[model samples]
Target: MAHLPQVLVFGPPTIFTQFEPQYSHKYHFLNAWASSLPLDQFLHTHNYEPSSIQAILCAGGGTPVTVHVLSVLSSVKLIVTTSAGLDHIDLLECRRRGIQVAGAGSLFSEEVAEMAVGLLIDAMRKISAADRYVRQRVHSGPWDFPLGSKLGGKRVGIVGLGSIGFEVAKRLEAFGCSIFYNSRKEKPFISYPFYSSVVELAANSNALVICCALTEQTRHIINKEVLLALGKEGVMVNIGRGALVDEKELVRCLIEGEIGGAGLDVFENEPHVPEELFGLDNVVLSPHAAALLKSLPLICVTLWQGI
Candidate 1:
C-alpha cells in the first residue's frame, strides 16, 4: 500500500465521523481526540513519527491551534480550519513559522448572511415570540399579541463590510432597508453611507448587524456606549464572534431595556448563554450555528478543496 500523507486532526470526534470515510484513502488522520494523552504528548507518541505529519485539519472554532501546538508539530506545513473565523488559530505564529493557514473563505458567506437576515427578521417581527404565544398562550385567555417593528425603510448598519457583510447588505436592500456600514476603510465603489465610528453608526441605525473579523482591536467593539447609542428602538444582531459584543453588558442591556431587541447567533462563551436573555420576547438566540450547511457532502467537499 502507498504511504498516505499523515494529517493531525484537532477537534471533536464528529470531525472524524463526518469526514474520515471520504478522505481516509487519501490521508492518514492522526486523531488527537481519541488519545488519552495530552495533545503535545499525543503528538510525540503517535504510532507515526511527528515528522510524518505535514498538515493539520481543524474542524471548528472550539479547538485552538496555539503556538505551542505549532512548535510541537514542527513538520506541519499547512493548517486548514473548517470555520470561516480565524480568531481561534494563532495566525501570527503560523506566519512566523512560514506555515500556511486556510479557512472556509466565502463558502459559508451566503448562508451566514441569510441567517443574519432571518434572525433580524425574527427579532424585528417577533416571529419566534409569536410562535411561542400561539403554541402556549393562544388558547388560554386574552388575545393580546406583542407588536413588532417593520423591516422596510429601517436604517441598517453593517459592521465589517467584507464578503459576508456585503451579502447581508445586498439582501437587506431587497427589503427596502437603507444600508449604512462601518468597515476598516470605506470601499470606493460602494455608495452606502459610511461611519468610521461604530457608536455613530449605532446612533443612526434602527438595527446593527455585526459581521466583522474578531481581533484585539475589535474585541468588545459593541460596548455599552455603542449599545446605548443604539437606544430603546434599536435592534442588535450578531453573526460574528461573541467577543465582538460585551456579552455581560449585552445581557444587562436586554434586562434593563437599554436596547430594544437583540438577535444573537454567537456569544462570548460557547454552550453557555446568559440566563437573563431567555425570557425576553424581543430577543432571538441561535446556537452559533449560522454557518451550518444543509448538505453535509457539499460542506466536506468544500472543506477538502480549501485544503
Candidate 2:
C-alpha cells in the first residue's frame, strides 16, 4: 500500500468539513481540533520525522499560522488559507522562511460583493427592523411603518477598490448610486472619483462601504474621526474584517445617532457581538457569513491546486 500524503487541517474550514468524506481516502489528515495536546506537542507526536509534514490547510476562524507555528513546522513548504484576507497568517515570516503561501484569492469576491450591497440596501431601508416589527407586533398603529433612506441617487464611498470592492461598485452603479472610493493608491484607468483620505470620503458621501483588508495600519481604520465625518444622515456598511472599524466607537456612534445606521457582518470578536447593538432598530447584524454559500467549488479548486 502506498503511503498517503499527510495534511494538517486547522479549523478544517467549512469546505473541508463538507468534502472530508470524499477526500479522506486520498490524504491522511491531521485534525488539530480532535487532539488534546498543544499544537507543537500534537505535531511532535504525530510526526516522527520533521520532513513528514509538507503542507498546512488553514482557514478563517482557525489557529493563525504564526512565527512560532512556522518555526516548529520547518519542513512545511506550503501554507494554504481558506480566506482571502491574509492578516490571520504571518506573510512576512512565511516569505522569510521561503514558504509558498496560497489564499482563496477572488473566490468569494462576487458573493461578498453581493452581500455588501445587500447589507447596504438593508441598512438604508431598515429591512431587518421592519421584519422584527412585524413579527413582534409591538407597534402602536398600522401606519407606524419603519421609514428608511433611498439608495438611488445616494453618494456611496468604497474604502477598498479591490476585487470585492470593484464588484460592489458595479452593482451599486446599476442602482444609480454615485460611487467614490479610497484605496492605498489610486487605481489607474478607473473612472470613479478617488479620495486619498477616508475621512474626506466619509464627509462627502452619503454612505461608506468598508472593503479593505485588516492589517496593522488598517486596524481600526474606520475610527471615531471617520465615523464622525460620515455625519448624522450617513449610513455605513462593512463586509471586510471586523477590526477594520473601531467596534466600541461604532456602538457609541449608533446609540447616539452620530451616524444614521450600520450593516455589520463581522465583529471585533467572533460569536461575541456587542450586547448594546441587539436592540437598535437602525442596525442590521449578521454572523460573519457574508460569503457563505451552499456550495464552494472555487475553494475546492484552490485547495486542489495549492496542495
Candidate 3:
C-alpha cells in the first residue's frame, strides 16, 4: 500500500471536517486545529520531514500564508484555496518561490451573482423591512409601509466585469436596467459603457453593485467621494467584499443620508457587523454566507475539483 500524499490545512474545524470525509481516501490531511501541539510546533515537526507534505488547502481567508509560513513549509509546491479571493495569501512570496496556486475559478460566480441581485431587490423593494412590519403587527394597512424604488429602468453599475460581475450584469439587464461597468481596463468585447473610475460609474448610475476583487489597488475603492457621487437616491449592493467599500465611511454615509441604501453581504471584518447599520431601514445585511447556502454540496464538489 502507498502512503497518501500529505496535505496541510489551517482553518475552521467545521469547514475541513465537512470536506475531509469526502476526500480522505485520496490524501492525508494534517489539520492544524486538530493537533495537540501549537500550529508553530506542528509546522516545525512537519518541516523535519519536508518531503512528507507538498500541498496546502485553505478554506476561506482564515489562514495567512505569510513568508514565514512558506519558509517553514519549504516543500509546499502548491497552495489551493476554496475562496475566489486571494487577498489572504502571500502572492509575492508565492511568486518568489515559484509555488503554484489554485482557486475556485468561476465556480462561485453564478451563485454570488444570484445573491447580489437578491440583496439588491431586497434593499430596493424593502422586502425584508415589510416582512418585519407584518411580523410585528405594524401592518394594519398596506399604506402603513414605506414605499420602495422600482427595479425597472434603473441604471446599474457593476464595479468589475469578471465572471461574477458579468453574471450580475446579465441578470440585471433582463430586469430592464441599463448596465455600465468599471474595471482595470475597458474590455474590448464588452459593449456597455466603461468608466475608468468608480466615482465616475457611481455618478452615472442609480445603483452600484460591487463585484470586484479586493486587491491593494481596490481597497476602499468606494470611498466618501464615491458615496457622495451615488447621492441620496442611489443604492449600493456589495456582494464581492466588504473592504472593497470603506465600511466606516459607508456607515457614516448611511447615517447622514449621504447615500440612499445598501445591501451588504460581506464586511471588512467577518462575523462582526457595525451596530449602527442595525437601525437603518434602508439597508439589508447578510452574513458572508452568500456563496455557501443550500449549495454546500456544489461548493464542496467544486472545492474537491480545485484541489
Candidate 4:
C-alpha cells in the first residue's frame, strides 16, 4: 500500500481539525499543536526527508505563517489557506523561497460582498437601530425616527476592486449607486472612476465600502484624515479586516459625529468590540461571522486537488 502525502498543519483545531474526518484516509496531517515534540524538533526530524513535507495548511488569519516557519520546513512548496486574506502569511518570504500559495479565492467573495452591502445599507438606513427601537418598545407619541438615506443616487467608493469588491459594486449598481474605486493601481477594464488616493475617494463618496486587504501599506488606511474626507454625512462599511480602518479613530468619529455612521463586521481585536460602540445606534456591528462560508467544508474536500 502507498502512503499518503505528508502535510504540516498549524492552527486552532476548530479550523484545521474540521478537515481531519474528510481527508484522514487520503493524506497524513501532522498537527503541530497535537504534537508532544516541539514544532522545531518535529521539523528537525524531517530534515533528511524534507520533500515528504510538501504542503503546509494554515487557517487564513488565525495563524501567522512567518518566514521562520517556512524556512524550518525547507521543502514545503505549497500553502493552502482556508481564508481569502493573505495578510497573516509572509508573502515576501514565500516569493523568495519560490513556494506557491492558494486561498479560498472567489469562493468566499460573494458571501463577504453580501455582508459588506448589508452593513452599508444598515448604516445608511439604520435597520439594526430600528429593529432595536421596536424591540425596546419605543412606540410613543410621534414615533420620532429619523428617515434613512435612500440607496439610490448615492456615490459609493470601493477601496479595493478585487473579487469581493467587484461583487459589491455589481450588487449596488442594481440599486442605482454610482460606483467608484481606489485600488493599488487602476484596472483599465473597469469603467468606474478610479482614484489613486483613498482620501480622494472618500471626499467624493457618500459611503465607502472597505474591501481592501490588510497590509503594512494599508494599515490604518482609513485614518482621521480619510474619515474627515468622508465627512459628517458619509457612511463607512468595513467587511474587510479590522486594521484596514483605525478603530480608535472610527469610534471617536462616531462619538463626536465627525462621521455619520459605520458598520463593522471585523474588529482590530476579535470577540472584543469597543464598549463605546455598543451604546451607539448609528453604528451597526456584526460578529465577524458574515463570511463563515457554508461551502467551507467542500473547500477542504477539494483543497489538495486545487494545490
Candidate 5:
C-alpha cells in the first residue's frame, strides 16, 4: 500500500476547518496548548510515529510546540503556520532539521490594525464606560460623559512600523492625525516623522499605539519609564503582545493617573486580567480577540494557497 503523507497540526481545530476544509480528512491533528504541551507523554499516548509525519503546522502563537515537535520530527518536510509571528517557531531547529517553514505575511495585518484603531477610539471616547452605564440603568439623567479628543488633531505615535504598524498609520492618516513612528530602521517608503526611541515617540505624541512584534529584544519594552513619558494626558493602546507591556507598572500608572487611560486587547497573563484594572473607568479591555475577525477564515485560505 502507498503511504499517505501524514500532516500533524498543533493549534485550534477552527484554523484547519478554515484552511484545509476539504483536505482535513488527510491530516492528523494533535490539538495541544500553544505554550504548554507535554511532548513525551502526548507522543507516547497517541503513538505518534515521527517518521510517518511528513508535515507539521503550528497555527497559534509561540515557539514551544514548534520546538518540541520539530525536535521529534527530524524528517518532516514542511512546517506551515497561519500566524505571522515566528518568535514561537524555532527557525534554527527547522534549519538544522532541513524543514521548510511558511507563514502568512500581511494577510492579517489590516485586520489587526483596524482593531487597534478601534481600541484607541474606544478608550479615548470612554465607549466601554458609556456602555456599562447604559447597561446598569444609570440613564435617569442627562448623560455627562466628557467629550473625547478627536483623532484628527492629535499626535499619534506608532511603535515598530512593520506591516501592521504601517497599515495603522495609513488608516489613521485618513483621520488627519499627525503620525510618528519608532523602529530600529526607518522605513524607506514612508515619509512620516520617525523617532529613534520608544520614549521619544511617547514623549511627542498624545496617544501611543503599540503594534510591534514580540521578540527577545521587544519583550516588556513598554515599562514604567515609557508610561511616565506618556504622562497623565496621554492615552495608550496595545494591540501587540501582552508581554510587550509591563502589567504591574501599567496598573500602577493607571491607578496613580500617570497616564490618562489605556485600551488593551492582549494582557501579560491572558484571560486573567489584573484585578486592579477591573473598576477603573478609563480602561477598555478585550480578551485577545483583536486578530479574530469574520474574515479570518478567508485570510487563512489565502495564506495556505500562498504557502
Candidate 6:
C-alpha cells in the first residue's frame, strides 16, 4: 500500500466514485474538484502539500489547466482526461513540464455521432417545431406546413473526418445519403467523395454537418461565406465545438434566410447562448448535451481504469 501512487482528480465526484470501486484499493483517490472552482483556490486545496501527489487527472468541462498549476506540482508525472477532446488542455505547457497527457479517443465518438444524426433529422423534418405547435394547442391552423425533405438521395457534406465524423458518415449512409467530406488529410478507408475545401462542400451538399475539433486553425471555420454557400435550401448541423462556428454569422444567416436552418448542441459561449436565437423557429438548440447519455458513466469508468 505504501508503494502505490497518489492521484488527484479535478472533475465531477461521480467520475472518481464510479471508478473507485474498481481501483480504490490499488491507488489513492484524493478529494474531487469541480471545474468551476477558481484555479488559485483549487491549487491551494489540492496541491498545497504537493509532495503527496504523484499524478493529476482533469475530467471535467473544457477548462484550460494553467502552467502555474503544473509548476506547483513538479512531482506529478501524468495527466489523464476522460474526454476525447484535448483543446481544453494546454499541450505546449504539458510538453515543457515533461508531464504526459493521455485522452480517451473513440470512446465518445459514437455517442456524439448519434446525437448529430438525431439533430439533423429533427432540423430537416421540423420535429421541434411540430412538437411546439402541439404543446401550444395551435390546432385551428391547417396542416399546410411546408413538406419535409427526406434524407435519402441528398448530398451530405461532413467537415472533419475524424472518428466521430466517420461514424456520422456511416450512419447517414443508412438513409441513402451521398456522403462528401473535407479534412486536413484524406482517409483511404472512407469510400465517400472528398472535397478539397469546405466552401466547395457547403456549396454542393444538401446538408452540412460540422464534426471537427476546436483549435486555432479551426476556430470559426464555418463563417458567413460557408453559410452563404449553403443556400436557403441547405440545412446545417453542428455537434462539434461551438467555437468552430461563428455565432454572429450564424445568427445573421438564420435571420436573413441565407440558409434553411441549423441544429446546434453547442454554442460559441456555452451556458450563455445569444438572446436573439430564442426567437428564431428555424434553429434547434440544445445545452451541449450531445455527448451525455446513459452509457457515459460506464464509459467514463472504463477510461479511468485504462488511465
Best by TM-score: 2
Q: lDDT per residue, candidate 1, 175-283, as tens digits?
A: 9999999999989989999999999999999999999999999999999999999999999999999999999999998889899999999988775788888888879
Tens-digit lDDT track of model 5 for 20-120: 65655555555443425476666667676777777776654433445666767766888778776666677888888777888766778988899899988
Of 2 and 3, the candidate ranking higher by TM-score: 2
Q: Give lDDT per model, in order.
A: 0.87, 0.86, 0.84, 0.84, 0.79, 0.81
lDDT of 2 by residue, 1-307 (tens): 1387777778535567776677778777778756768787887887545467788887765577899888877788888777788887889998888988888788889989999999999999999998888888865776586679999999999999999999999999999999999999999999999999999999999999999998898999999999999989999999888899999999999999999999998888865899999999888998878766776745565566657
Q: Rank the candidates by lDDT, best first.
A: 1, 2, 4, 3, 6, 5
> How many clashes in each candidate?
0, 0, 0, 0, 2, 0
Instruction: Please provide TM-scores, in order, for all candidate models, with all chains considered together.
Output: 0.90, 0.91, 0.88, 0.83, 0.88, 0.86
Model 2 earns a TM-score of 0.91
Cα lDDT tens digits, model 4, 178-280, are 9999999999878999999999999999999999889899999999999999999999999888899999999999999999999998888765799999999
**What residue runs in model 2 are displaced by over 4 Å at the alpha carbon?**
33-38, 41-51, 138-143
Off by over 4 Å in 1: 12-16, 33-38, 41-51
Q: What is the lDDT, from 0 to 100, of the residue 230 in candidate 3?
A: 94
Candidate 6 lDDT, tens digit per residue, 119-211? 999888888977876677756866665566787888999999999998999999999999999998788877888898899999999999999
Please say which candidate is ahead in TM-score: 2 or 4: 2
Candidate 3 residue runs with Cα over 4 Å from true position: 1-3, 12-16, 33-38, 41-53, 138-143, 296-299, 302-307
For candidate 2, what is the lDDT? 0.86
- Across 82-136, the per-residue lDDT of candidate 3 in tens digits comes to 7788887899999999999987778788888999999999989999888887788
Two-way TM-score contest, 3 vs 4, winner: 3
List pairs with backbone clashes in candidate 3.
Answer: none
